[model samples]
Target: MVETGRIRVAKDKADLVKSLISTDGATGPFQTFADAIAFAAALGAKHNRRVPLGEISKREPSPIRLEYFASMGHDCVIKLLAITETKDIKILSLTEESEAKRNLIFEEYANGGLEILQNELRGAVDYSERILLMLCPEREQQEQQNEEFDLSKFLS
Candidate 1:
């Protein structure tokens, strides 16, 4: 598995794109529909041992379009643009919303809301890292193979 020091939550599409590109083995800037999908799949495979192939396959086959999926936290959202064809599958872009929230929390901390700001900051870093790790291909593969991957043990 690819081990990066720490994953920072991406603040926008541009930042997310930059991080994905910065990963080892990513070639050139991913600027097209095909490039983004290929990169996401590769990144997913590298870190997570799995990719969200099932999620991609279940989408309606049609022209490319942006879609969003909600995650555990209200601030966490997965966004993607899917391109589907009879023989080819592609995702133009994929990003999460936690970075925006991270910024807000940072602002709050700066503004003297120490209590709430501290709590938010505590989880933001780890949450963002987990999001990135979850994108790893190895993780995705493992998830697809075992429906019963337990989290409780790890948590406890």
Candidate 2:
């Protein structure tokens, strides 16, 4: 039961990481890649373990990942990278986007114009998951795309 509890906690942590990564739109600017990394690191640290940054760095992450990270927030990305290096975890470049572009993304996310804020919250969760995978290339898995970006399908 103790081991099961630990496993459950780890799974929850992983899910939280996924959510942080894929969140999108204007609840605020999408979390920067740095934020995502820090969140992940904190989660690991809380468990008294460190992420395998050295191993992750050795693998080349996809360009989309670099662009996404850069877009989320460049400064955060740099800090995360430095931390990863110090921790001997592998670091990979993901998506890189400018502040302007990232704000535009938030604008689009707010498009329902406040009428559908509740509905938008659900979408935001899905977006967070997608973004997380985008930053952590090693976590990418081959899954079928849903029709019209269907959240039910993706989340299911």
Candidate whose lDDT is highest? 2
**Runs with alpha carbons beyond 4 Å of true place in candidate 1:** 1-12, 21-37, 41-84, 88-128, 135-156
Q: Which prediction has the highest TM-score against the true structure?
A: 2
TM per candidate:
0.20, 0.24
Expressed as tens digits, the lDDT of each residue in 31-126 for candidate 2 is 543444434333333333432211112121111233444455543534443444345333222323233233222222222222122233355545
TM-score of decoy 1: 0.20
* Candidate 1 residue-wise lDDT, 1-156, digit = tens: 111121122122233333323245543343333233334433332233221111112121211222211222211211121121112232212223333332223222212222222233344534345445544866777887675676565784
For model 1, what is the alpha-carbon lDDT of residue 154? 70
Poorest 10 consecutive residues of model 1 by lDDT?
77-86
Model 2 misplaced regions, further than 4 Å: 1-14, 19-35, 42-48, 53-64, 74-156
